[model samples]
Target: MSNLIPDPISNVFKSLAIAVSLLVSLVAAPPAQALEPIPVPIDIEALDITSSIDLHREAGNRLQVSTAPGADGIVRRIEVPSRDGTNTNWAVFSLANTSDEQIDRLIVAPNYKLVGSALFWPDLGSSRIAAITPSQGIAPERQKSLEADVFLVTLDPGSIVTFVAELTTPNLPEIRIWEPDVYEETINAYTLYRGIILGISGLLALFLTILFVVKGTVMFPATAALAWSVLAYLCIDFGFWGMVFKLEGGGSQLARACAEVMLAASLIIFLYAYLNLNRWNIHYSHLALTTLILILGLLGVAVWDPSIAAGIARLALAVIGILGFVTIAVLAFQHYDRAILLIPTWCLLIAWLIGAGMTVTGYIANDIVQPALGGGLVLIVLLIGFTVMQHAFAGGAIAQGLISDIERKALALTGAGDIIWDWDIDRDRIYTGNEVEDLLNLKRGSLEGPARDWLDVLHPQDRDRFRATLDAVIDQRRGKVMQTFRLRSEDGHFRWFRLRARPIIGSDGEVIRCVGTLLDVTEERTAEERLLHDAVHDNLTGLPNRELFVDRLRTSVVRSKAEETAKPTILVLNLDRFKQVNDSIGLSAGDSILLTVARRLGRLIGQQDTLGRLSGDQYGLVLLSEQEPDRIVALADSLRKAVRAPITFGDREIFLTCSVGIAFF
Candidate 1:
């Protein structure tokens, strides 16, 4: 038997198929006997209707309700005559005998403002006996159900009667009847499901709105706007707004319509930013303009005629939505970063649009359409929110990197003891880092001086020159400048500093700002000065050597000739016993004697005179003269006496003499 299993499996499948067919036949078979209908209670006292002896009559078949005098959209009463030959306002329910028993407590529901009502009768001639009206007041959640607002009536197994309803204001003249338990169950179940959907959508909207607030992303706000419009539309259509807020009339419609316009505007804005629409080859400007115009038109309609505005807004948004879907599809194919996110979002939007359009156009019921719309809108809102946050994080990451780089550069500058500065040429403002005070050796707040006063802290002699240098960089078309100058610090001591700057040029080739570094060069300048002095001054006697002496003489001679003054005089003095003294003692002793003689001779000169060592054991002097040979003789005699008086060297008393020869030009 096991070896024949393959053939057995085929036989078993045939048997299972026959069993399934039998089950289907049994499930689909007609009932053998009719069941009795359950009789439910219809509480007549709940109707709360007061009847009149004669019904109020209006001339026309259709009634038009308007606001009363001195009231803002408030109408007290309305009388609607029957459209047919019947001379009464009647609500008729046609029932069939599906079961064997009567339907006792069948509820009839209508849409109306239920505050003040006239009466409900079984028939025109019958006395008002028993009717069922809403037990609860303004139930928004319940309004989402098929059995939200209703009146209960008793009917036979098979009967058709025209029920008369006298009213203050007439609503759309259509009604539905259902069994009490079925009505309650359906209402409760539908309310629960619809409430959940609405809640999810509302929460999604709130989440997206928060994202928009946090990230300032257009997508979040746009998605939220669309969600709000859909939510409001559902609320208005299902009478949820009236139930929740106890508000009625055109005001609710206006709010819903306004939400629609906002939805359109928000979508346009989001698409523009997300898709970079302006940069696209095809101009979206006209589309944007058209959207704006439509939104404006919707707004005008909402204010002037709110009843029709909601429909117009829905139609406009649907058209815009289709266009947006196409645009987003194109963008996605082009591989835009956010377009991938929008593709799924647009698909959900399509579902929402189809569901909403079907409901609005009366193709489907509110229960089916609302859940579909709510779910689709929730997904759309969440997708947009996620994309927005993703972009925000990416942008934040790049910004953080740039900020970190800037911070590192600043730290490096601080560590290197460099002062970074910026000078706004047009504004005449100077900005500097904290390192400025440290580099400039300035007191804590001294750096806050005005731009013009920046040069005030410079050394008085260098101030004009520094200003000239800086101006050359700014006004003289110099692009980059590097110069050294002395700046006076807070302690009143001048320190050398080097300023290096590069101009920030504007588009018109004008310097807009100058960014630079200021470095303390006091140590460098001091070292340079020492090296320069060592190069031109005598090392042993600390007197100007031949190089410096000749330079001064040349300068003086040129100046004297230019001024027509007296010619300068140059005198060379040779130490007579300098070599004999060196041979007698030592080189050290000889050097000491030469130093002593140089000092004695240096005191004979005036401020306008020059004294220098021309060479080993040879000295020179320069003086200004008015061509008095006698004056020259007297000066020469003074030098000879001074040099001849020099004596001591260590423990020895040495006498030194020099031969002086004077020359004049």
Candidate 2:
């Protein structure tokens, strides 16, 4: 029983050991041969011939077919492992033409910037080969087609041939098999599409550049830079640069890298300026500046070392992506109109960048990303253009409003005697209507020069004041000016002119021009002065009224107190029998007698003293000089005598006696 149990246990251990050994052998074995035979479709015009293909990455350009490895379950578009530019990618696939006739096809690698490619046909036999090199150009065996690199392949009926494509490019390539006519048609459509995109982008760039020159706004130049950078990148991507410059493979790659770096840097710059982060938030602005500096530094590094430029550009895109989203959020929070407008476009751009980066890094295939990139770019451009146009339209509306205002003012100032003038501050030139010279009574073209010439025609007292008002308008960059000054006419008389000016500010907030009307106010000033004089004087007697006398007395008292001088003396005098004289004579005779008394008193008082008609038959006098008590009494007696001696009203000799009262402060 013990022997039988041991035998069964030994058999079980042997079975387990054999199973472990088989599993180890299978795990340690090399990958299966990838050269699977793929049947060519006899019915289809074009075929996505990459499903059975195998991709293997090998270091260095000198790859041997014997050492090529295999991969399985590949799709129409496959992402091969990427390495430095020195590495070679091999795609192995076998094609069997099952038809009775021979099939001619084109093997296409749809990348414009492909560095170099080679094809080994007839079951990977190097004897039959087609190759293309960057320096020597295309070989006879390879076809020169549109933007994509092309290779010729022929399949015989009932024959199976494995093909190996050796690709040496920075990124992995997407391979396709196509008929000649279909490829030509596809290329034609692609060219047209790319042409439209490039044309629109170019026009947008030019428009923004013109705006920058015309308006001098920060956002214009920034957007222009971004537009130009995008255009350059598209040029490189679409193979236009290659056709124009005919650069070598390395040089072309370097140019592409530089273009990409510039694109990212320009995007960062545009966002910083477009969002107005510098003015809105201090900390974010600093962060943006720092990021910009880093990007510029990367650009410098790319110039110095082109091999790592793509990596640098990717890094820049990533950095900007994070910072840009944060800034957009902040702007949206603040309810910035432009930032709100930019949201959808900015999101599309970020998505494209991410997808493109993934495609380049082999996280995704090129086929999916390429189409999205094209459509996204166009959409982003359209949306950004729309947003920028809002600013342009807003500026145009403001300018139009200013023009309407100027037109209205001009219409209002088109009166027969009004003189309209415009001062070009920068050129120091003054332009005026012909009426200015006629109004000033000067010769023709007398005031048709610089602003200083106009100033020379002004009265000496008004010249400095007018200049000061104009300077203030230009310096402060605010407010309109309404100054009333005197301008000297040719006849040596100064006429008062009222100047009403409104300054026109440029984009930089500087007063570029001043427009105004010069209206003659000489008659108005004369009327005003006459009215002022009549307000303080008695009409019948033509002497200072009681209000004027009181004002003068108050001023004299304050001056005496301030200067510690003698206080002014006041005397009130009344004519005796004045009411009896008015009652006997007519009212007209009474008025004439009062006028005669006022003239007599005016001749008695000095210019420094005040003489006034206080009321009917009453007079008041103020002496502003220091006088002894006897002198004061003598002055009061003189005033009384002057009023009492008035006579000869009409045909009668009116006589009067006066009583006087004196007061001292």
Candidate 3:
């Protein structure tokens, strides 16, 4: 039975081995097969009707009615229809020319033309017929006229030829009409428009800048209108809307020449307008006028003597244009901020870049293109003019408003505040208004000239900090500086003032002056000082109380630990039966004793030392001296002995022996 059954472990091992072998084979093997190449689908259906026909039409059928295709095969059959003859038709196209003289005498004409569309035939494709709108038949011819090719065949008088009019079939692909000669006659038209715009914009910008400098009456509205017009024209040109559609007489060259002449003239005029050359120099104005006249003369020459104008003259003129604009840009960049003048000039300068870009990537030109590419700067001048006008009108208003705002704020600040002061750092003057006297009770006329005028007036404790703040405010050029300081009064008292100010902006956006307000906060400050005093000092004696003493003790302990050479000591003492004596005499007598004790301690303590009334009949002293502990103990003993002197308060001999605590560092 066991032999018949399969070994489970061996079977499992065999399966595992097979899987491992398969994985190993996969790891060691090359890829199963090379990837198949994907084929790009060529959609010949998208080619233009003309290209398709040119590609697909029969080689023999490449002939059109136009003479451009030299003499070819015979037009086999001719036919036309008459409106009355056929069911409501016009003329018949199917007929034989019974009387056929030479084509010089035989003529056929169309009564009307369809205004809806344009038609073109292409001969290039497998089925080279590009059918646009299915089969659109033509109106029937009124009569028969046959013209035979002289080389192919000659028709004698009265000789017959059958002619058929068939517009029933179409064969070709679709066409994208956007792509044409990218830059052509339209460039001239657009250039002319742009030149006009540029000239106007430049003139306006110049005029406005002059007005801003001279602070004069200027024409801004006209400039703005010109700018808008230029922009509109540029948009129209760039959008390619019907730019070359006006080429009727003489062809595209005439239209282009017209546009170029207009735009170029606009540029010259704009330059004059912006610079106000008329006012600046009479000779320059006349010269500018002559240059313009010469440009006009050049246009006339182009129209009349194309041979001369098309020769080396154009190259010479282009060089002049480049040099003149470069010179103007260099000057404008240094002296004036005229984007119109700069941008238009730079546009002409980078023609090479634009040309290269357009060549590498073919672009479709539109109707708007004529006004843009056509050497017309009329639109550009107009645009600059309008911008200059806008800046003149609105910028003046803004600057004036800002100045008024600053003045109003300054006046308001002085009037509303209890103190007004000026820090003329350069002039070394600290001028305070009459209100400062009211706020600080300081000598009014004294602070007008020098820093030392008020230097001696400050509380000895606050003098350094007050001087530091003043110096910092000016040196760092802080904006809207805020300072809260105590100023010494004529009465030998200190008063608090909160000074705040904003810096004035100059035409160059720099701070030219500081306008500030000083509010008298002495009363509020006094209240705050009193609150702090109550929190840390005895209300009656004005000495540091128990809380302040403990805080000082902790600070001394931290300092003593840091210094090993000199350690801090705290002397704790209790009165020698002073409580019993106070009860025997009275609480008032004990109070008198305590007051005397507080006064003595405060006097004996140095500037850095502190003295405080810890509690009734208890006092503390802090001594910051290099003296030994015995000397400190002696000082404490002296303080205790000083308090023991009998107090003569309202003719009463109040004697009290007290213990004193001294902390030494």
Candidate 4:
């Protein structure tokens, strides 16, 4: 029955069995926890002490101490040897107030500081405790002080006593005998040093803020953030805020945390903004925000539990700092063309980080973080100044390029005989970059008014059509259009122009403006007219040829047929022996004789008559008159006598004669 159960029941049974097995294993296991003290102490012997006060070398120098904590969990209570030669000894020293002034304080301190270490003296009162090695990191002012990393004891005049300290390390540190004048000088120097750093960084931040506001550029904002971060760092590191603002306890720690977070976040922002990472790698931007959040979280932990958070913060900062440097370096390398100016900045930042790493790992005893950070910050300010100069140069170059392009286009337009014009439909105005007097033979500003002003200049035959075409363009009924028409100028002469216009559409798909160009086609129109004239008229004598003469004769015949009192007459005249004149002289002489005969006949003919060149030397004349043969005979005689007149060719003279024939209808 069990084997025949469904698969679901068996699967549930197997899962439950596995869960039971895991629970059994966990219950059987021992709880894992730390067995050592909160801060594990290192024991030191007095025989290892290398240096001490001259008077106490024999008695107090042979002391042994343990860095482990006392009953209160604070590092104090130095234990002395019970027997004559036991495991440990204590350092006993005496001080005599020889001067008239009373000695108020004494400082017992190490010559150098170590991380995760502190020194305590119960004999000096509770508030007089000092860190031998500051776990919270050294401030810029404290790092430079001669007596800051020491324990202080208060005493009256002429008081002699012995002091004991838990040796935090095997190394013996110096004991500072504090004097009124020396302590005053040390405090003053520390303050002055810190004030200079703060002032310089503050000014730089202000300068960068001004630049950001003026330039309205992303680079300036990012760089300004960097400068402000430096100011924050100097404030936190030098304890200047503690003096001025009195931010104590959690407030000071929190302020320091915020400053550190700003420092890291600013570096990330500066790198991405300098490179314009939104155009390149958006993922890096997201990563930068994530890392910043992580840094903030770690800092929050420091406010609650500093011991655990300090280790984590250091490790996290080291990793993040290295990663940030590498990421920016890689991006800079990839975008070296645009990031060339940032090379000095990133290089100095990496070097500063290396110095900080050295300080963290105990290789460097002195503080390098201050100088490294200060130098890097100054470099960033200089880079911003240079970037501004480069931007101005680039702007100038772009403007010059635009000017050259306009000049080049202007030359091309002049060569193409195109004059540009702009029309503002909303204003009902037309503007043209052309000489009104040269193009339209008008006064200089005649066409500078409204659209109606230009329309008024159009020839009467084209004025209505021009208005219609222009309306079509403004209405966007046509994408672009070209039309040729005659325009009457100021001198009453008409000139042909081809106007081409295109409508410019707004975002709403309505035409807001029209840009047009005009081409003067007067010479072109004249050539076309001459071509039409040559096809129908004789080229040499400038008289209507056979085609035109026949058309006129046909019209006359039609008219005469319709009218009862009117008749049509035609006359043909041929120059007799005209070939002899050309053969004797030249074709030029023959042309001159023909011209003379045509001119004479032109004078004799009435305004209603038509005269044309029929052939090489023959001419024809038609008239609308009575169909009387005597009238035709008289007109033919007149034409014959007209052709027999004398003609002159240059200096040569010749007489021309013609045979005439007449017909009546």
Top-scoring candidate (lDDT): 2
lDDT of 3 by residue, 281-360 (tens): 68867877887787667567667643333232333335445645664666576666553445564464346324322422
lDDT of 3: 0.47
Candidate 4 at 639: error in angstroms?
A: 44
Write one digit per residue (lDDT tens) for candidate 2, span 1-665. Answer: 35455778889999999999999987985534445567777677677765656665554454333311222233222222323335465555666677888877777766442122211100100111124221111321577643556777777776666555555543334567787788788778778877887888888889878867766667778888988888887887777787788754556667767786788888888898777777776986787778777777766665666546656676677778766877787788889887788888888888877766665554665443554575566567667767876887775423432345666665556635578778888898887867767877888888777877877888887888888988899888989999998878888888888888899999988899998777888899999988988899888887788899899999999999999886789888888887888889978888888888888877877778888888888888897653677888887777777766648766777778888888888
Candidate 4, 1-665: lDDT as tens digits: 45576889889999999999999986985332211122101121111122442211233323433323322344432334323342122333333333345434435343323221221110110111222221111211222333234444443343333344324223343445554355567667767866776787788788778866665667668878978887886776667666678655456556655665566667667766666767777887787678767766766665665434445544554565567557656766776544666566556656766665565454664434444455555565556546644653565323322345676777678778787777887787788764645666676767766888876778888888888888877665457868998878777888898888888888877787888788888999999999999999999999999999999899888877787545668888988898899998888777877887888889987788899999999999887643567767887888887777667677877877788887767
Candidate closer to the true structure by TM-score (higher is better), 1 or 2: 2
Worst 10 residues of 1 by lDDT: 117-126
For model 1, the local distance difference test gives: 0.62
C-alpha displacement of 429 in model 3, angstroms?
Answer: 7.9
RMSD of each candidate relative to the true structure: 21.8, 17.6, 30.8, 22.4
Give the clash count for each candidate: 1, 0, 97, 4
Cα-based lDDT for every prediction = 0.62, 0.70, 0.47, 0.61
Q: TM-score order of candidates, best first? A: 2, 1, 4, 3
How many clashing pairs does model 1 include?
1
* Estimated TM-score for each candidate: 0.41, 0.49, 0.32, 0.40
Question: How many angstroms is residue 101 displaced in model 1 relative to the true structure, after the best TM-score fit?
Answer: 6.7
Best by TM-score: 2
Using lDDT as the yardstick, the better of models 1 and 3 is 1
Question: Per-residue lDDT of 1-665 in model 1, one digit per residue for the tens?
Answer: 46556888889999999999999987885323211222222332122112211132442344322212211222223233443434333322122333446554443444421111111210101112122111112211222322134554555443322233433232322244455676578657767877876787678678767766665545456656756765675565445776777554455546656765676666677777666687786568677867777677778877886646655656677887898888888888889767777787778778777766665544664434545555566567667766666766666423322345676787677678777767888877777755667655777656554566777887778777777776887786556878887877667878887888898889888888888888878999999989999899998999999999999899889988899876889999998967888899999978887788788877877778888999999998888743588988898888888877748766777776789998887
